[model samples]
Target: MASKTSAISASLLVAGALAAPSASPADNDGRRARGEAALARITGAEGRTVVESIRRTSPELGDWIVDFAYGDVFSRPGVALCTRELATVAALTALGNAQPQLKVHVEGALNVGCKPDEIVEIIMQMAVYAGFPSALNGIAAAREVFEKKGVRTTAMEAAQPVAPAR
Candidate 1:
């Protein structure tokens, strides 16, 4: 019995050793491509203007935003870009520090197929869990994007709908 267990353990160890490395050069290239694509998608004409303003004001943080946040972290395949953007948007909105990135991610969420309504809904939901202030700040940022795109939004639209008369 002990010999059988040892043999199985050895086989498992060999299999693990033979597995491909998780972070190869190819992986890095793929990540860079995804990051560039995401950057382009998020920074549409107007969004790029926002980024340029930031770069002029804070060059170091701007580099980190492009390289680390988008390149290193977002390029990973663990989660879809839409999902990641939603989470990032919510966190930043709640933290109330990075409104610029929050707006970009909101647009990113839309570019990646998340509807404007859905983004608003996420902010509303975050309000319940993260507090009114956080949600309010998030809404403020989202409002800017909606306005830029000429999307009409109201508090009633964000609320849950009631069933109509039978």
Candidate 2:
């Protein structure tokens, strides 16, 4: 009798595993394709690999990152990726927990047409409002990205030419 009960329990577990509604392959494909498209749109082909890595490491979070962030929020009719990246940079920089991601978004910001100067200015603004520490960390993070891309910080300073004395 105990053996029969154990067999029945095992059968039920197997059934449950078979019946579990996993994310559909088509759905997964669509999400992945959209994610790639969105990443390409914002960061170009070179940066898409990084975004793909993010997806592979955390499938569940990747779904939200791709489907929700890139698909739903980013695909909204009016808001461009550049604008969204700016907001993402600011939010991440302000939160200060996800500095790595903030660095990626800094590159995303540049890929989507945000001038380096604009990003530096945003970091400076965060320093004043979000506190010096957050801003300092944000600058450090952004600097890593700039260095990786072979962009010098002086370019940002040069872009914003100071007015000469009257």
Candidate 3:
């Protein structure tokens, strides 16, 4: 019985080792390509502008954005791009201090086929976890992005103050 257990453990160890991804130059190149493609798919024409702006201040940071954030993480399979963008929006909203990034992700979410209302829903959902203030700020950012794109949503109407009964 012990011998059988040892054999099974050895097999499992070998399987785990085989399943792990090895870092090679070719693998890195592939990851970079996939990441760039994913970023381009999400950001469209704005990708260059975004990366260039980041590069002007921190080139390494810019590369990591493209290579790690986009490439290693965003390019992974399973979750849809639209879902990923929404998740990003949610995370940024929860952070409450990344308005610029939140706005950019709001735009990215729109680009990836997320409806304005869906963006609103995600921001509103963040309120439960991140508090009313964070949700309010996030919704405001989403509203700005929507307005810039000439898109309208129920969230926009919600942003307006109600008049008291005369």
Query: What C-alpha lDDT values do all the predictions have?
Result: 0.75, 0.78, 0.89
What is the C-alpha lDDT profile of model 3 across 14-109, one tens digit per residue? 999999987753267687787788888888778768898998999878878888888888998999999999999999999999999899899999
Tell me the lDDT of model 1 at 127.
75
Return the lDDT, model 1, position 112. 77
Q: For each predicted model, how many residue pairs clash, with residues at least 3 apart or on different chains?
A: 0, 0, 0
Candidate 1 clashing pairs, residues 3+ apart or interchain: none
Kindly list the per-residue Cα lDDT of model 1 for residues 104-125, writing each as its tens digit. Answer: 7887787777777778888888
Candidate 1 runs further than 4 Å off = 1-33, 46-60, 153-166
Query: In model 3, what are the clashing residue pairs, if there are any?
Result: none
**Model 2: lDDT of residue 62:** 55
Error of 3 at 117 (Å): 0.9
TM-score for all models, in order of appearance: 0.63, 0.68, 0.76
What is the lDDT, from 0 to 100, of the residue 16 in candidate 3? Answer: 97
Residues forming the 10-long window of minimal summed lDDT in candidate 2 = 24-33
